[model samples]
Target: MRRPVPVFLPALLLALTVLGIVTVRLVVYEFGGPTARRKAVTVPPVDGVRITSMTVYSGRLPPCPEPAFDDYGHHDDPVIRPLPTGGPGISATYELHNEDTEVFTYTIRFMFLAGTIQVGAFTDEVVRSVRPGATVRGTVRPETQDPYTCPVTRVKVAEVTKVPDSELPPPPERCPPSGLRLTSDHTAAMGLRVVGLHLQNCGTDDYTLDGYPLLELLDTDRSPVDGARITHGSGGVSGISLPGSGFDEPAHPLVLKPGESAVSELAWRTDTPIVPYLRVRTQPDAAPVTLTLRLDLGTTGTLAVSPWKLPP
Candidate 1:
């Protein structure tokens, strides 16, 4: 038995030497609960957006956005321990180097890989208001609930979708009892952008408006946009000449009763910073209502507003 052991030891040493034996170290990472052997998350060369920092939690498998891709088609792997309360987690800070000459909003998709094979996938995350020259910082945790046995070794950006920031939908709001609700309609053609602010009389009282809306543009952070020149008509705002845009309409006193509405126009050039919020007052002293207009207004430095008028 001793002779066999010696022979085996020599064979093992020979194999190790052929494998180019080097000092081996175990890589353990802090995952908030325990140290894990997960690899450091890596981001490949991606345009527009990059992951600046990432933290991955193992021992708890994350549920993929597409459950069809998640493990256990009713069959469990031998290594999957039933996680009573915890699962894997991942949080990443995304730095969008917009490098583009235009402002953009990005939607990123992520997947978890184990040894070159994707073990899970997650929902897409939308990061808004990424202006030119690296302006916005968004943290994405595209995670879900599940218990996976395979350690999340790497994270990969599966897909990325980008759109101009001016095109985003306004924040959703229900018609309130203030007898008024404001919304927007967006249109773009030949690089000209137009947003129609729709004011509806949702309550029983009559809401009256005259002339143009009192306007204030805001950045994504809700701060006033500096150097914004909001003109009263589209004449100097870039698209006032478009047919049926109503920027040329003359302002007159209008009354909106219940079930009635009026539309105001906002126009700007496509080359602009993201104006995500627009503070609107039907009158100079009326309560200000902020709409998520996504107006392409900052870069070009000019915005045009039309008075409340009947919709075309």
Candidate 2:
């Protein structure tokens, strides 16, 4: 045989060449080589901002209020009234800033933890670019729920930047503590005239009074009134100049602290005739639990059964 001419020599050479090429590529890439530099685009860091203030308005139920729309259809900051009664309608305002170079979108929402659980959400227009030192204002309208112990209701930021998850600080606390009474005449056009008691300084440091007291009429036995139109008196705290329905409005929204007591009045008239006293219950947002008033009509316009009177 022409002597396999040491085939190992050729094989060795090929292996050496391959190793050299790989080594060169590794060294080049390790030090900012053109091939490595032309790879994927760089993503800058993203920054976020928190909301400074939020407000809720007062109103009735069913169709709640919405944030005002600008001529361009963009939403504007809302002016909320305190302690909106009836149903769930809240107006929230937020101030935010983005230190990142990219555009971001923010979502605002509310969470009701106690009594009932619900998430109230609203969206803001896309933010094209929040420069390293720029600020933006936003607003959201959240639906309210039926009267219940919404003591832990709060506003939060649900989203920011391109990130799918984000949250904000908890909202201030509100303790709606008040008393109410109801009287029924069964003969007036206005079936029920309601009066309220605003317990002053009955809330925590975080919240203030938003609206007058609230009163609800429940059957002696427990049944929800689906369609009830109750009116309140125009009178303030001094003395009730009660409405025809006899329901007077509290002069100021009651702010009760941890252990404080206040008295209020409410009245209503029903078409159904009864012989025994009616059960009048007061349901507030927070403390002072629920108080029930059992009134015995002594054939005249006066209270026969009150907490002061004990049954013998």
Candidate 3:
């Protein structure tokens, strides 16, 4: 004869199954969601700079984008930025301990990641004019990227660059009343480096140009760098080649109307890299503009510049 099943057995089995489901759902929620996506940053060992006092919170950005100026935008005009300053995201402060004897400006790049995946492109945070042996605070807020998720766990450094504020050139800006604007786009491959000089005719008058730009070198203190030679080609940098490298092309006269543009290329190679600044003249008669071009001439102590021409 068959025996009747215990009534408690069915109830216990049901309770166990419900408990398992709840546990699995909680784990999924913890691993992948907005709340779990909150930020935490990690900083690698950096010299003369320390990243500290990081706070991650859930917040929202302003309702609209803000007009701002920087290198990442159009070379000739102000670009609208994401404008996250209304405070709904991850933010961090960095302390720059200037170990050198002179006041220095620090440019730090931060990257955000989610697990093994990067959340957004690396963003640069500037710490300006830090005095020797003194500490100054700077904020690393995302300009266009909203990597609020996993900043604490995922924020990291891509690279860091510094220069004396006095030696640094004016940040790139749009054309002034003079009808011309000058800025640069930086590129690198292995040890070979190139800085593309962009000259724009942003005024009502027609602008004229002939040949390569007048260039000079400056050391960290804005003093002229002795013994550095400026060549007319890429200096035969081995790792890479660029179009319109100013070398083989004969520089001829070109006229650019209002809103037109021209281009040139500066190339060099380096091992330990020196020379932090450049004084560039779009033309000899035109006013010279100093740029923090940061040429790593290595021991070669030479630079190559291409002639100005229309963009490809």
lDDT scores in order: 0.64, 0.35, 0.64
lDDT tens readout by residue for model 2, 1-312: 112346686677578777873221110111121111111112221235454443322122222235688999998966643232423243444566665454443333333232244444334334433444568866555544333323223445543332111111112253233321112322223433332332333334433333434433333332333343334442232223435323332345444444444444444333332212222333354432222223222222222111111112
In every candidate, how many clashes are there?
A: 5, 30, 10
List where candidate 2 sits over 4 angstroms from the true fold: 1-47, 56-89, 103-116, 119-128, 143-152, 163-312
- TM-score ranking, best first: 3, 1, 2
Model 1, range 1-312, lDDT digits (tens) per residue? Answer: 111244586677678868987222122332333222323334654655566555454443433322233354663334334322333254556656777766777777777665476655665787777777875666765465344444454566765656564434334455564667777778899977878888888778888888999888777555788887888777676547567667776889998888899988788887656676777788876667766656765644778788889776
Model 3, stretches more than 4 Å misplaced? 1-123, 127-137, 141-173, 234-246
lDDT per residue as tens, model 3, 179-250: 677888898877778888888887899988988899988776567888777877655654434563446577
User: Model 1 Cα RMSD, Å?
Assistant: 13.7
Error of 2 at 195 (Å): 54
Worst 10 residues of 3 by lDDT: 22-31
TM-score of 2: 0.23
Q: Least lDDT summed over 10 consecutive residues: which range in candidate 1? A: 22-31
